[model samples]
Target chain A: MRFGNKDLARYPFLREALSYVTKNEFKIEDLDNSEFYHLVEKAKRKIEDYVFEGKLAYQIDYNKTHEIIVQEEVIIFLISLLLIKSISIDSVTKKFALFESMRFERYLISDLDNSNQDDKTVKLILYKIFEDLFQTKVDLEVDIFNFYKIKISDYLDHPIAFQEREWNLVNRTVDKGYVYLDGSEIVRLFRNELYLLIIDRIKKMNPEVLPDMIISISDSLKSRWEKMYPPLRAPGHQDILPPCIQHIYNQIDKGENLSHPARVLLGTFLIYTNKSMEEMIDLFKRLPDYNEQITRYQLEHLAGKRGNTKQYFVPSCEKIKLNNLCFETVVCKGISNPTQLIYRKSSK
Target chain B: MTSPTTSSHTSSSSDKLKDSITDSFNYPHSVEDDPNKIWLEKVFRKHYFNSSSEIELDNYVSEHEFGFRLFDGYIRRHLNFKNKRELIASIIKFSPSDIFCSPARYQHPSASMDQKGWIGADLIFDIDGKDLQLDCARIHNMTFCKNCKLIEKEVHTSCSKCNSSMVQIVELPCQNCIRNLKKEVTKLVEVLHDDFGIENNSINIFFSGNNGFHIHVVDESFFNLSSMKRSSLTQYLLGRGYLVDNLGFRIDKSDNITMLPNKIYYNKGWRARLLSRLHLQLKNHRIDDKFMRKITQIKETNKIGISGVINNQIQNISVKIDPNVTIDIHRIFRLAGTINSKSGLVKSRVNNLTTFDPFKESCIREDALVKLDAFVDTKLFFNGTSYKIKTGINNIPEFVAVYIISKGIGDIYIEKLK
Candidate 1:
């Protein structure tokens, strides 16, 4: 958890760091400058302030919102790292120059604002702040938040990255053309097909064994899926869906030879996509020791179309009419790959 | 089809997985006696009762390597036991109720060499002998007498070392490992009770016999769950706030399998479980569709397929995991908007020709980065079942815009200039 500017002000150095990030103008060159002096003084004062206050922010009013924002500080830390990556000596000097212009104290602090804050006095103060307030950069680098992070490479292969990037380029915006499908259309197109598929799989079964059989099939699908896309090739990048897939992938990876039925269940959902409940049932039926009736009940119940209260069931057919679906073009036509499908179509 | 018994016998034969003989044999006396005596008795009893004669088997003690070969002893013992039928019967009557006959070790061709191979110790007792070692000794033949005890390859040479012997064994860990594991288990139990909803009736926690604890949600509600629901539950268990990850588990060898109430993301730690749950809710229903519409997205990018003529914005879009797979609809539309706008020009210019002007761009791409709003839509499903089929569109949240703006997409400037 972390606190924002409102909370950081209770500690002087953190407050200074926050202020410097927001207000200071850094030059690409020259460490000794007036603004640099102020930066040093401010940072030093914050540190001294923290030392005296003894890190006492506990008594201060803390609400749920503040707590959440504080917890998300790692995200801010990443941004800071990115900023630091681009900072050169010249940029440091420029920032110091901006600081000196603000009539800051000189030389009691070590000037991290860079050599541009070469006013010997400002450098002293800045140095003091770095020494006292912040932990060593080396230590920070190894911190769990920074070092133990899962690199994108651990989850994605080159081909998947290339493909995802290409798709990203292909679908650039919401204006060119795409479509959305309504509930009724989806019902007409997928309802019956899904229903029949589910029924067919469970039509003939030793009633007692049917449920377990269906569950097992689900697990097989999931396990097969994880095998297909291991965590090293996690499907999506920082994407919502991708992370979800990654979670499932990790589970299968850990418990590959699991004997439990639950393990099988996990494997099924992770990999089984683009198929309706009925289709999944049909897929399950092809395996050994499967019952048909239980699958019928489960699939029907799963899609919320089993009991007949004008249920918007899955459509039974494959061919989709152009008029029944909705689309909105996100990218301009003729700009990139013409054959790529980059639109999201929603059906009930 | 053959009867089940025949099939079972075939199953056993196919795998060649023997029901090891160590289970049946018992030492003549307590294991504390001369360790050598205990070892001999255990091996002798297995072969004598294997329905094989004991007279053909032989037994002897040797100082050169401190070992015994079961195969030679098997034939002598088998013949001897068969000849002394009355004595064998009397011994059996006196034996403990648990004792039974076991298979004899078969002799192999090169039993004279001390080379490490399957010595097949029919029964194994205590292994605490001074310089004691048990191995799969290669059996050569029943003809070798006690003085000419079969010697395999000498112990630990460049050519061979004693390989694994098929025998019953027990193992215990070091003190340090036990202490550390106990502490971890205690901490984990507390975490489970506090967070996982694993109270008395619905759940049970168990040791995975290695590292980590397993919480079994025995709630009948979860029994016989389909793949989808189970996945959802798994996600919820591992998600953040559940702290499924922090349930410390020691990674070392142990017998008690620790049951993890929920799956951990990394070695141990929680990611955002609630977010995943929210995502599920969204995916199940189209409720987040409105939120998705609020965030500006590109138009359909499906140029190859037939598409609807409506000019509506993107919502409830699905992205495929396969990167090579073409964008279905929303991705395409988002691309089109980007390609045709000023943001596109900025993006292209940054990557290609002259330095791009961020000032003029006004962070247009940033607008697209806003976290897309999302919600689960119950109205979309015809049936009212709500266990979890979370489906919905996610709008880029507002906070994400700054970062997205900083990171420009490809070909943005070119489209803008055009």
Candidate 2:
């Protein structure tokens, strides 16, 4: 069950990996040294890549990948986590978790490649990991996709966590308290568990003691992020908005304080629907924390009339969902954006 | 599930039933004044005392909690027994209106829910006739007014004699509901054996006293499964929440076009069952095997839609078993061979499902002829005897009388000593 240091780097989130990486107690001051700068920069670059490319470009050299690279990768994840926490955007953090989990799974699945490890060795490792992580019983059923027969209870114990009808228990082959599944299903299930594990580590991290260098870098990245995607004005067509947007509008109308992303989603959606600055600001009037000047500035920024005038498109449905904003009304099913919600309702 | 007002049930009867009764009683309307409850208590006490047959006690009876609803009293629970003798002792002591046993075996069976050290529970599937909406209910059910004692042959907003909302709807499940429920059970049992790999012997089917059936899967494999796992099992038999995404089938949502698969991975699971049914539907046409590849699952001519056809197929294959019954680990399930006080009928084990007839098989089997007032006109075939019951006093055997009275559609006709 003991994972080598090289394997630990690939799965730094593993319980065994915690012992190797956390050997020395850390302080905020430790992150400032030149020696740690490369790690911090590498960590920042990973986030930048994920935010822009929508992928984590991480690779594991199964053989001859240096122990130093291993140690570095392990420590970099911790640094990357802190950077994400310091940046403090839920959308970025959530998406990064998904990408990072998939990246980790890619290597974990790669380790089971028959060309790299003998059949016996592959099974021993796979069994150990399965038992260690999920307390599941698995037997290799077919060669391709590392197909295995996993006990039904193990698969169904948290099957709903998948949230997809495909992962529903009714759809799978279950016999003698076991479910037959391919490597991808097993790998994705692992990714879901790992995502939770990573989120937990990220939650425990204190962004308050963040070093000045990390904070400055995060601020610059955040601005670059703001300019990366832009918004613009649209025709003021309808009085009503999509339910998701309407829900937020209603909340603001009732003087409820909108969360940062909630405000962003609402503002951009309003601009796309062609709400004027005065009209948009008027909706914000009942907010408990409402101030006319600040509201005007925020709405103006959203309308792309403020600094760095690269107009932002209304936030995509994916982004809204990641930020937990979309109401996902049935009428707006295929419409990918909130502005489309207007067109959809109008067409109907 | 529908609009606020209850669905209608109508009554049909002949006044000839009134002259037939010499003695009478009513329940559910006035529980304190119910002599029927007293008669039922006597019936249950006599059955348990005389029947020396083995009471079907679940594994670890000492660790199982028991609950009982005593005649004319509130339900009592948190009681445990050491053996069948002790359980029977308690039953005789109470002469309970209903009996229930916990599916879960706990370390401290009598302890509070939180404190009860839960061990494991048998997987159960409850399929109730009441849960099923049958077209035949109108044929066999009626609405009876407790105030005016008026029986309406059909659903009425109010009684004809008095405008009373204090009315009860009663049902005598026709052959259609029974046949439908039996089909559900058959489908469930097949899935348990073929899909779950549970042995046929371990799957015990029981007539759930009244208008339902309780299936207890006593297999050791499922005993340790958590509620979530059991819920998954329920979903499997229920044939729901199956998305074609993982099944290698794709439907373009925007255009509503489905990319039908020529070769479905139908070797096992739901797809296997689907393929079998699809085979039967396509068997008559020889063009199926040739054009089956061509027409495997393409868009049906536009109107009804592909989703509709696929959905109909899925619904046809789905078994109607209650997920709550299986998922609830702490449920107090009714025991077989025990009376469901609601209907005064024993929840007997179905040894041979096809031959199992509840009306003929389930009863107190006493020789006494009891006179009862029929609140509704209904037909009954009991112990090889058939009666076209009318809405009036009628003389019937003790078994049929108890069964009807417990159903809230009849009351004992008490002879006034004039």
Candidate 3:
């Protein structure tokens, strides 16, 4: 999905790329004679550099590349790749300059009293850039203990970030080097890394000068992006969960002791839906013998905090049947797991 | 079923019996021998081709992968035939020492083709004498250390003399072991019928001739169970990884008592089992008087005091089964009519498993009397008779002779009696 009006206003380069790709209409249009010749010459030079001098021989200016190309689809295609990090800037300074040129520095430094620290300021700007580009809203909390390594709390001053929040929200005692982000937030960060690979591939391609070729390439890349990040459901979509998961939710709601497999299935489902560890522990408190410490430990373990830190996926339909916990409804017929069912129902 | 006719006054009757037993043993000599081939051919012809009904035979071989173990310990596997008669003919020709068949069905069982995918597998449970905990006579077994060449009489994982970890334990099942195996078989049958909803007709129980029992479920629904599903079933049967709290008991905060939902008693599998066990425990007056009074007073409400004693009682009831055999779909079980190589007794299928005694029902040649040359002093029980013999030659029934020889404690000798 394309960025909204607010994101466009915040990042002018994206708006400029969008205008260039659509010819001011956000739709493909016939390239002007002069613009077409310029694109052809640029494509020819890129092909020669790639073929003879290798990858380092050619590099596109992230800020000024729109001037060289006039095809609306090609411009949009490249910008989308850049947004996804499929393309990279030559250096960290150049990357910071590109972001600064997009007017990201004003909003980033507006909240901070001291924005002179280059690394921290750049990280904050990058985090905001990712949030705006992906339209993902992250709840920035000042957590004392680190739940996951890379977090906004790690970059922000602890005293300033924790100023008005409750003492419970800020892990005041533990002095872990890194700050905590929700496990699901960490997943979102990793997803951004994947998007960067896609962008890098697009950045390396010698642009096809033909409008038809560029249009088809743009359409294919858009399809790939859609497939890579399927739209996540809103919290309200929990009502549409598969019958087996709904049954588990009902059991947990009633404070009933769940079987090991049942607990695992519920934990996996909640984790996939981006529920925080505390929220999961709260849900588990309904269990008859719920010990808060033990519940938190188990939830953290499922969240990939313990041992090898490998996150587990929900068990397949076959595994559910094996556990004798399959409570299949008509809707579950063609699906293999609860996650698939969730995605299917929510997409519909 | 054949009973030997011998004249009471004949002097050489023992010699004739000995020679007849020896001849029967020599018939299915090896997979390549002509005598074995001819004998197997006759057997297949009689049982398969000339049988009165073909429906039973057709149903038996339709979805099975057959393998034949030669006398030399090499197994000829992945053999499939079009019809029951053809399969029987092939078995007869080969005259394998042990006939084994897979419980799993493949698209092209005998062909190495890409379309060869597993359709499903039969739900098979095996209860072997080797795994049974018996308190009867101890049969001599050997344990050898691979690392240090140390030998021990009893089975052990590590060598005592050299402290080597590479020790292998070999088990020899005696009559007592078979008796214990029968007990496990009974438990399995009860659990299958009561808990699993399997009908009596759908269950096929067979004695493995040497030590164990194989229970095969022929129900159409059970054929397609995945290995993971089968593994879960094994776990349930073995009582290994069950959460006891999931039986639906919750502590009622109002009265500070553990309350059981009424629906649990009405439920079918483990819930019902737990309810019945609770009833038995209370009725038997096993608990202390104070706890008994508490339970009795709250019997109508289905709530009782939460105590450690009650929790332990709930964990005590579960079926014991051999988990590995049930989970493995490709495991080859011995064919019913084939002779067990170790015991020299036929792997017989019993019509009425509950009343079938292994000693009498599993005997291949009941009437043949043989002489056993014992290497050690041993007391043996077989076919309603118990014999205690010092290290010497003793005349016994063929079944007892085979049992002794199978245990590696004695050798059988056949000669013409003067």
Fnat, model by model in order, equals 0.00, 0.64, 0.00
Q: Docking quality tier of candidate 1?
A: incorrect
User: What are the per-residue Cα lDDT tens digits for candidate 1 across A1-348?
Assistant: 232343332222243444434453433222233433433333333222222222212222344464333322322322212222222122222222222211122211112233342344332333233333322111111222111121111111112212222111111111101111122221221222222222222232222222232243334433543443333433322232322234434443432222223223322332233345554554433222234676556555444456642333222112111212112233323322111221211221
lDDT of 3 by residue, B151-240 (tens): 566667689989988876445556566666777777667666765557888888877776688788876656776655566556556655
User: Which candidate number would show the highest lDDT if scored against the true structure?
Assistant: 2
Q: Write the per-residue lDDT of candidate 2 for residues B1-418, one digit (tens) a residue.
A: 1001110112131111111111111122125567787777877788778762635886588999776666654445567789888889877766777777888899998776677889999888888776677778765666778888777765556777799988766667767878888988998898888778789999999888788888888878789988777877878887877765433445555435443544324256676666565553323312235434433444455455556666777888888777777887876778767877767777888998888888877766664887889877788887778977788888888888888888777888888899
Candidate 3 chain A, poorest ten consecutive residues by summed lDDT:
A165-174
TM-score per candidate for chain A alone: 0.16, 0.63, 0.32
TM-score of each: 0.17, 0.73, 0.45
User: Candidate 3's residue-wise lDDT over A1-348, tens digit each?
Assistant: 443333343334443334644554432233323444444344334432321222223333344433333333354334333322322222211222222222233433342323333335333434555454444333333342213333222223222222211111122111212223433334334333323433345456553343553444334543543453233333445666788887776664432457778888888878888898876765665453345787777777887888669788889999998776789988887889878877887788
Q: The CA-based lDDT of model 3 is what?
A: 0.52
Q: How well is candidate 3 docked (DockQ)?
A: 0.02
lDDT of 2 by residue, A200-288 (tens): 67777875677888889888877775564332222254353566776775564432457778888878877776777877765665454
Best by TM-score: 2
Determine which window of 10 residues in candidate 3 chain B has minimal summed lDDT: B1-10
Candidate 3 falls in which docking quality class? incorrect
